[model samples]
Target: MTGGRLSHLAPDAVLTAARRVMARCDELARVTADEGAITRVYLSPEHARVNRLAAEWMREVGLTTRQDAAGNQLGLLPAADRDAPVLMLGSHLDTVIDAGRFDGIVGVLMAIEVVRLLRVADGDGWRSPFPFGIEVAAFSDEEGTRFGKALLGSSAVAGDWDDAWWELEDSDGTSLREAYREFGLDPGRIGEAARRPDQLVGYLEAHIEQGPELDRRGESLAVVSSIASARRFQLVVEGEARHAGGTPYDMRRDALLGASEAALAVERICSGEHHIIGTVGQLEAFPGAVNVVPGEARFSLDLRGEFDGERDRVWNAISRELDAIMGRRHLRWRAREVHSAAAVFCAPLLQDVVRAGIRATVAGAEPATLFSPAGHDGMSIGALTDVGMLFLRNPDGISHHPAESVAGGDVALGIRALAEAVAHRGAERG
Candidate 1:
């Protein structure tokens, strides 16, 4: 573990910022739809509550704040020249059902603290002195928990919002457009959230590593190399349904059995490949009954890799394997791609600054670099501007659950590293 104070920051101030971040995370955790767990989804009352709270915090720190038409909460710190292009910092505020408190919330809070740290004290008030303006965004949706479509909020910001998304519905049968109106936002005005490239510099986000890489190595932070490319599919296996008691073992075309074999093949093949991950997170059989052999089975496939070509290649392999399994079982199968996103590599300049930031905070060792396997808002934001990320160590790499954790000390280090990175970027622009 590295042990050293930031050369230019006061230890007490850093610690105080870290504490404030953690305390705010705790505060946000309580604003959830689920009574016993944290589950703040998009366009819900919980979302509105958090946005209001975030706006209040932004004002307390001297930022001009607004909720974008897409429902993303935004706050801006002006540069000496108010018209300067802005450097943006942000992460999603929405969470998966039963999510950990730190995943997205930590990043948004850390960005706020970074702004607080960068302000220079004037006679009666503080002022921003950076070469460019700074903006912090709390994206409304990233997990797709309610709409079943991830990155809706960021997609709007990146000018990629699809009109078809308005037809998407949640578990309660409420359409996205109706929900937007219910949440007091105009769906027609979502375009207002789009940010032009000329109005921005780049995006930087600090998040707790959703995996255990940092914690396993006894390190507190790492520079993110890239967000993984991903492809997702819904697969269906079809066969003739028959009475379970009457169907002979040798004559039966069992869809469930074939689907199970395909699932195992997915795990086996993906495990043999490097940086390629495949998950069958959802599966179901039609006419699920004890007395009937399942006539159809459907499952989801989420495939990801560090590179697009390799990920697609692995998917081809998995498809071939599925064909073999279905053929052997005398069943028919088909697949529909539900989602795909190319990998977003961090800009070299941003990576360099992140490394410098880590170097300044950690003592006597070079900073570690890791590619993120999980998807992030950066994946969408990359379409609009260059994106970079810093990861704080999460114990046991557990995320999307109640057990996700980050140490206060690591957060202190993260805030310092982020502030230093922003300062480094400012110097470069100057």
Candidate 2:
């Protein structure tokens, strides 16, 4: 019952499934808030539309579909034993502002395709079932695009919903609770989305590498080693504003100059460390007039690493450097912690299954292994179940932008590997 012996997974069938996934991604891309760009957010009209479309596709493949109270779309195919715990596969469906088509969309569609392939593989036409049930979840708010807090949907599913989040608002100033009501979901019933430990086997997700490692090595797929530990901050620098022309260079305390130095320090320190990344994604200076020196400056820092201690160490180093820069410039600076998540390592059993699945595709080649720096719904779902991920090659590793791309051929191989992984997992359970 190894993945290699799954005779029904022929090349033509896998390619057809891949093409369908690509087409479905295109279809989902159109159901967005912006007409010209993809911008679907949580609990919006676009969310409802995509859920309906996903449900329709789920039903077509003989799955029992439902939208949970947290607005996640779910579909289930039962096991031979009706009461058995289920193995789940899926990723988020929501998109960031002007997002690429396949960040989370492909995983959901690929999960559906896997189910279809499984049904075809089962010669008895649903009579012969696997040892565990299978479920695909299209989580509603992984991007946190509207609310500014990521993993809202998966956190609810993981039973980690925070009451404080109810007060969180979008750019339009609409609170989460109000949006929930508007989306036809009762805010109080969101707890129903949570799943207890005994009711599941594990979770599996497939996503684009979102980095150049795979594409650089000429590899089509890889097994993820772990998701990185991350910390985000909003940093502010303060100084006295003065007339740019009137003030002498020695007397001027320029906050913008201090902030720029700090940004450069982040890159310098992080570049010297292995697997540690630092990004200054946003920056702004106040009273932005050409003749006036900036009185204050604000910037964001997103720092991540393979381990928590190393990440914090880099942050501490960056902080020291920032202090030196501000002191030398006669300015003051501060940082506010906005978000944090611990590293999540993949389960060994799941990793083995994924490796076997990849072997089924490439025959003799060893699957490349990588650690993901990008955050995902799995970071939240890991609280509920063991999580494993497979990475598809993304050209140039571009993601979260209009230019993100994945090849149809690579997607075809991803489908076969994912289906084989499910089969291998089933055999293990038996």
lDDT of each: 0.91, 0.91
TM-score of each: 0.96, 0.96
The clash count for each model shown is 1, 0
Can you tell me which runs of candidate 2 are displaced by over 4 Å? 1-4, 120-128
Name model 1 segments beyond 4 Å from true: 1-8, 121-126
Give a tens-digit lDDT track for model 2, residues 1-430. Answer: 4433476667999999999999999999999889899999999999999999999998888788999989999998888776888889999899999999999999999999999888633443341157788999999988888988889999999999999999999999999999999999999998999999888889999999989999999999999999999999999999989999999999998889999999999999999999999999899998888999999999999999999999999999999999899999999999999889999998888888888889888776799999999998989989988899999999999999999999999999999999888888888853
Model 2 worst lDDT run, 10 consecutive residues: 120-129
Cα lDDT tens digits, model 1, 51-146, are 999999887887889999999999998887779989999898899999999998999999999888887764565556676889999999988889
How does model 2 score by TM-score? Answer: 0.96
As for candidate 2, its clashing pairs are none
